[model samples]
Target: MRSSSVLAIVVVLLVCLFKHGNSVPVEMETTTAMTTEFTATESSRKDIVFNSTEGEMEKPRYPHDGYCGHLEEACSDERRCCPDFECYHSEGRCIYLMQ
Candidate 1:
């Protein structure tokens, strides 16, 4: 019937409006900040490429395993690594991502 068709159209319009209305603006702001920080960190890493020792460039040390190791689950949970790049600094080392 025509009533059922009109009801369906109203439901579709309501769903579309609700979907577009529910997003939080703060999330977009945070995402923008994260992107900016990432770009800066990448540029800084270029300096490490030239300044660090050959061994450091070849295989940076990790906090857990001494050489090129990933952070333990506990450490990662605590956000122990660097804010810009996840650094592993256990054995006098500062491990950062290449890019």
Candidate 2:
């Protein structure tokens, strides 16, 4: 019985992640010790936070063609993106603005 419940939790997690693009379970059964473990893990995951600092502040994006060096995919400053691409700080990804 306990093993089946654990397997169900694993199945639900994978189904939500791959088919629904969710990181957390939408609903859970509270009748088992495993539920408490899941709740603790989920709450702990949510408690984690990221804090940005100074000098490494995000900047605008710029344009550059291919060169001798390997181009970085992440955006941080003005030169990180192309002319049409803007650095979306909240999402931490480059977005095309000129389209």
Models 1 onward score TM values of: 0.25, 0.24
Q: Clashing residue pairs in candidate 2, if any?
A: none
Scanning candidate 2 in windows of ten residues, the lowest lDDT window is: 61-70
**lDDT tens string, model 2, 1-99?**
999999999999988778765555678657544433444465434433333664352332222532111123456643355445566667656677555
The residue-by-residue lDDT of candidate 1 on 1-99, one tens digit each, is: 999999999999999998888864544433434333445476446433432555445333345543332343223333344334454545433355567
Q: RMSDs, each prediction?
A: 15.8, 20.5
> In order, what lDDT does every prediction score?
0.50, 0.52
Best by lDDT: 2
Q: Kindly report which residue pairs in candidate 1 clash with one another.
A: none
Model 1 off-target regions past 4 Å? Answer: 24-99
Error of 1 at 38 (Å): 47
